[model samples]
Target chain A: MKRSIWAGLSGAVCLSALALSGAAASAAPRVELQTDPPLSQIEPFSEPVIFSLKAVADDGQPLEDAILELLLNTPPKTPWLTTDFPVVEGTMLARLTLPAPQGEAQFQQVPPIRGSYQLQVRVSPRVPGTFEPYTDLLTFQVPENPVKYRNLAILLSILLLAGLGGGWVIGGSQPPNPGEVASRPVQLVLSGTVLVAIATLLYISITAERAGAHTEAPTGQDNYTEPLNAEPVPTNITATLEDQAIATVGQAIPLEVELTRAETGEPISAAVLDINTTSLEYERTVFDFTAQTDTQGEFVWEQQFFDGAPHLVTVHVSPAANSSIPFEPFEFSQRIDVTGVAPPLFVRLVSLGYCTGVLALGTAAGFWLRRRSTQHAL
Target chain B: MYSSKLSTLKRAKQGVLSVPVQAILFLSLGSLSLWMLFFSSYPATHNTMHQTRHHTLGVGCH
Candidate 1:
């Protein structure tokens, strides 16, 4: 049970890492200088700069409760850049530890006079993981404050639309006119009013939906380091026969090979892995393995082999052309010497094998249920 | 007078033949009602566990 829990956690972390590795640069966490609205130029003293920095863990997991320390260079005219003060030495660091649920930190940095002040923001994680801290340096000026609009235009538009729609609906049933055909003007006016009301309702609903679209904190914003693909560049390949545990001459030994892509290290599926042996008996004993790759480039295979002699395992990795990335062929082998032990002697081994088979069957059933539902939807 | 009496008798026989047609219409209406009720609720009771999110991980694989 504990092993299973560890496996689940590891799987989650692996998926998170893979997702973040492909994230774009704009999604990365960085220090931003915020005014009431965005400013093109910064002037001195007139506007106060609000420093905001958000960090997400490298594993793509949220580091909810972490400490954010702020630092700023003093006096606005310290010769700190050239030689006197290094980046860390001249700045006074303030400890501002933020609690959980917010997972955000903001601070204000003001210089005596804004010439060219460098703002430093650092984030440290408080959880259990090997992660590098995040730091960003941003330079901005204190800009002149622009005249603030009272936002009366937005309010007036809303009220006008509402009043028009309400008046039409509250007027109730139209007067009956059984004696004569309705005139063109009356018909046109009625249709125009109804169309305008419908358009207004649709606009309101669409705007509300757009605003509600952003529900969760942005996962892609964390500056996740890209992965360096380590394709065990095959050097010298060698294999020797190790000790063997064997069954009857006709019985089959199952073997599974999983190959991942070289670039993203994601698993590549349906690529054939070959097995060679000194004797034809060993080679023919090899059964083809099943292939499947999950969302995070992971897969499993099931196959059986039947041979009493030493056997070799070789795996080749390949990817579809349409795939985002391709995998280079990787070859490795393990040799096993077989003694053809009697079937009566391995009761415990057989029982454990049965248990594993049961578990695999259960997993397959779960997958099948999901597949059927998807078909129904289609 | 005798011809008028015979015409009245033929009209009564025609009315008797229309009884089975009325019964057939009622049966058809009942069958239609049963079908609508049964099929409409079938979707409401459908098991959701059978739904799968697995397609060849196209763009959202990560």
Candidate 2:
């Protein structure tokens, strides 16, 4: 028993040492990317997303001869989109396709109405056994399109009118004569309701916006030093706003704050700024975040607002912890006005509801008239 | 002569087709027309349809 125990201990130690050596030999590579659509993500079902990616080695060298495969949530074994082309200038740009439906019960030609999907980007160095394969996942969103309401409204209206008209004509007390009365209030109401519905449907179809019809490409360069806020705060370090455009909901708001010294006119780099934002529509604990400026003495915060409410933001710029001089905190406030556009689904539903309610009343009136005529005939 | 005409009309009213059947047929036709027009609710992935013969049958262009 003692001899077997000693042999087992020696084998275990040998296996562990081999495992450590194997781990040290193989190392995962590093990947850095700056892409279009602001980030690598996109809104699904909207448009074909075009993006550029940058890949480099651990020593900060560009991998010019890298094999890349773009897969959509598929296993690594299945590579539909493969390229052996070198990533020249450490950058590669490609257009991603959003498939269109071919026919009924077909493969995924179009994206789902509402859901999130992962886009997997796999990169492998061409040099054999040098670096491990690197994969990155970018997520995108697809909003649901509510299209049932319009169809329901139209079909229901047609059914009601067909039933009422058939009953009225067949169950009438007498056939029309040349000297019969011309004006009929119930029939006139029925005609008017149907006319309104037809007009509404036409208007909706003409005004509705398609998802990907007007998708503009993102500017390929990153230039953060653009013109900013109108007002400049007077302090040891001043803040200048460079962006003055309205931000839409579910869209990125580029908040640029430029910092410069008042006395020496020198740019302050790596300074931290405290951002506190509050929404006017909903009151809650203030949302706070801290960000450091880049080498250009500017910090650009890309904020996305899910709601359409106005955000009142207060930014307090302060020096770094290792600064030689300590000054008072510079505080400034700005109001961000956000606008929300109703999705096509919401508009379709409201229009359908309005038309359906009016048509129901008209159909009821026709039915009453039909019943009265039938009693008189009997 | 009026009584004979009335009898013919009554017999025609009691013909082979019934009112309930007529109503059912009307409803079925109405529903089928709507289906052909507005089948907009589609699944994200259509592996089955794509494999089958009816792969290119898309609806709701207008």
Candidate 3:
């Protein structure tokens, strides 16, 4: 139950993070940054939490010689030790050690700030390099409960739709219509199905432990990190992600790959980016095939993951394309974690009941109409 | 003869309304009632947590 609560909270955090980042960045520099002990882990009055930042490039490469800057903001209500979140921003960080991979620069921040914290990573080329310094910006927060009772609110809406619709059919129908006789078989089937659904749901409700209602097995990916932006940039290959950060289970989650010239952003219509899905016994491969990009310089491969295992989608852009960017045969991968929570069985059963009841009632309404017409004729 | 003529007129009127037409009309009327009730009560119920929000409010206003 506690795990489920944690998962729900984390999933919400992930959603909000996406919302905060915006769908696409207009001109975000390639320097990627990640801070550990995600904002969700922050609470009021707790010990000053140290947010360790990891810096990398767009490709899966460790970024060295990066400079990190931090500013801590204090607002009202920082309690310093409690995880009650509404209270915890009170602890002061004794020191922050930013890793240069070769050297260290340290700093300290005062506790209990009420505003957002800003972290910036600036990467300077170390090896008498041809590359110029680039910067990436990240904003962190201890978010508030924006909308309380979210699930309960959605459930109320579903029930209202069902109730009003059901009431209409029930109140309108009368006997002695032709459809009443003709629809008997269908009515019987629907009735039986609804009864069975209701009984099964009831049995499960009475028997099954309530742990499934709120256990956190699969953590929500609301952890503030963008692998696409944080990964190491290969010398010659440039790849782009067609976002599917909002896909659900059993639905086709498409990752659109476009090979482009890093300097010009022009599509490499002839380049093929090979895809290999790192998942379960289902070692499926069309995503792994090397195919040429069309005139648009992009192709999409969709995978519908069934079970709740974290799968990494590894994409390798073939280095055959001619480009000014020194392309190494490096690969970039994103993990498709468990983000979707399937509707509970009880909710599904209620939905089934609504559907079956509607069908039967609609038939009855037809019969009632036919009977009225007959009466008028007589 | 007059009665028979009246009956024929009545039959024509009834004939104009086919089974499908009657069924559609009846169902439409039912749905309309539901829609009116739902829309009218939704705002009050949503805020006040009472399904008969309009009814109670109407009583108070009177």
Candidate 4:
């Protein structure tokens, strides 16, 4: 009887241990990505490159209903000439769904600039909480296009020469005369041109700011409160905006984010959250900051929108070291409308200064030529 | 006064280029300067004028 009892106890303990190990195994599913032509062979300003991705379980079986999100970021070191161009300096997002037949998906993008590109791949199940999400950061370099650079240099040189030649001939020939009254039409046209130029500059400045036109990393990895863990725990993260319709400039926009266990609805606390606001119109990241969720598994913050436009707010949650409940790192994004406002006085003044400086230089050159012409006449 | 006006007109016409032609040349120069300063894609030129592009023109560059 004593031997039978001991045997029964050992059997129950072994069964419990096996169940826990099985649960842990199911929690860790990995997504593997393969790039065609490989990353090393990618040439700048070349044709679009394809990225092939697959998600697999621990047993090496492909996960058919997996979704992959790819975030391609330009190198932080190099500044792009224009964010308006495709694949220039801003972040590009692509989504891929692995269908049943091949259990793989592909993404294609054209790399226009030459620099180190960081591609962040995040994989999760179609249905939340099936398994812990997986994220991988891959870096690749695109070689500089020597031909493009050479052509650019030649074109700019020609423009510079043309401008200088034109300015010299115009100034030398049409010297300004204080005694000779200018025609009414000529004066009108000159003033009109200056006004139009100033107005255009001001408009462009305001629009560019609203469009979030900057070439900087959306969010730096160093800003994270804690480094992401190798293996994240299974958790579901969700975020909501207080007023989803419209936000006003200079007003505080409230945002709330939470993390919880999908199965048990239990809150997960002490998660590090990276929040970034990107302007959709210009595809530029305007605001990026980091925060932590409170004990109740909630993070609430107020952000003041600078530009009036449609903005995407993205929250990336990662596990914190001292957290009682481990949680998987995941991203949540929401789009909101922001009302526009007039460009500040300083921006207008700067635009005016640029226009005035150009006009003044031209006027000064004309006067100098006029003095020399008058001496010859005398 | 009429002779003075005629002499002034003759002097203006005696220059290498006409007034209209000079105006066009000056406008071309202005256009070229604006394009190079604001819209040039060359890295060296763009990077060199990076601050003026951002602070003065309100064009966003990092």
Which stretch of 10 consecutive residues in model 3 chain A shows the poorest summed lDDT? A79-88
In model 2, chain B matches the true chain B with a TM-score of: 0.38
lDDT of 2 at A39: 29
Which candidate model has the greater lDDT, 1 or 4? Answer: 4
lDDT of 1 by residue, A1-378 (tens): 999999999999999887877574446655344543244454322233445555565444455655454444432422221111111122332222332223465543222232345556676655645345688776655322222112223323433443333222222213325542333333443455456546544554565466457445644622221113323423322212122234223233333344444445545443433333222222332322212233444433211122233444433344444455444544444444443322121322332333333333433343355445556776
- Candidate 1 — what's its lDDT? 0.36
Backbone clashes (count) for model 1: 5
Q: Candidate 4, what DockQ?
A: 0.07
TM-score of 4: 0.35
Instruction: Write model 3 residue lDDT over A70-167, tens digit each, in one string.
Output: 32333333222111122222222211113344323332121223345555545565443734566555566754322323533443454344434433
The residue-by-residue lDDT of candidate 3 on B1-62, one tens digit each, is: 99999899767655533344433443344333322222222332222322231121111000
Please write out the lDDT profile of model 2 over residues A29-71, one tens digit for every residue: 4344333343224432233333344455555565665644444
Per-model TM-score on C-alpha atoms = 0.22, 0.36, 0.26, 0.35
Candidate 3: how close is chain B to the reference, as a TM-score?
0.41
DockQ of each: 0.03, 0.04, 0.02, 0.07
Candidate 1 regions with alpha-carbon error over 4 angstroms: A1-33, A37-43, A57-62, A74-101, A109-111, A128-131, A143-378, B1-62
Model 2, position A263, has a per-residue lDDT of 86
Question: What value does the lDDT take at residue A377 in candidate 1?
Answer: 70
Give the i-RMS of model 1 in Å: 30.9
In the order shown, the candidates' Cα RMSDs to the true structure are 30.9, 17.7, 23.7, 19.8
Residue-by-residue lDDT tens digits, candidate 4, A1-378: 999999999999999999999888665665566765677777643455666667777667886666565565665522223221222243332222222223466645555455677777677776688766787677777665455446445544554453343334444444445554443434444455566557655655565565455546555432222223322324353333344325665345556777776767667776777766667656766555555666677766555454455677677778777777665566656666676543233433443344434544554555456556667887
Candidate 3, superposed: residue stretches over 4 Å from native? A1-232, A235-237, A280-287, A320-327, A340-378, B1-62
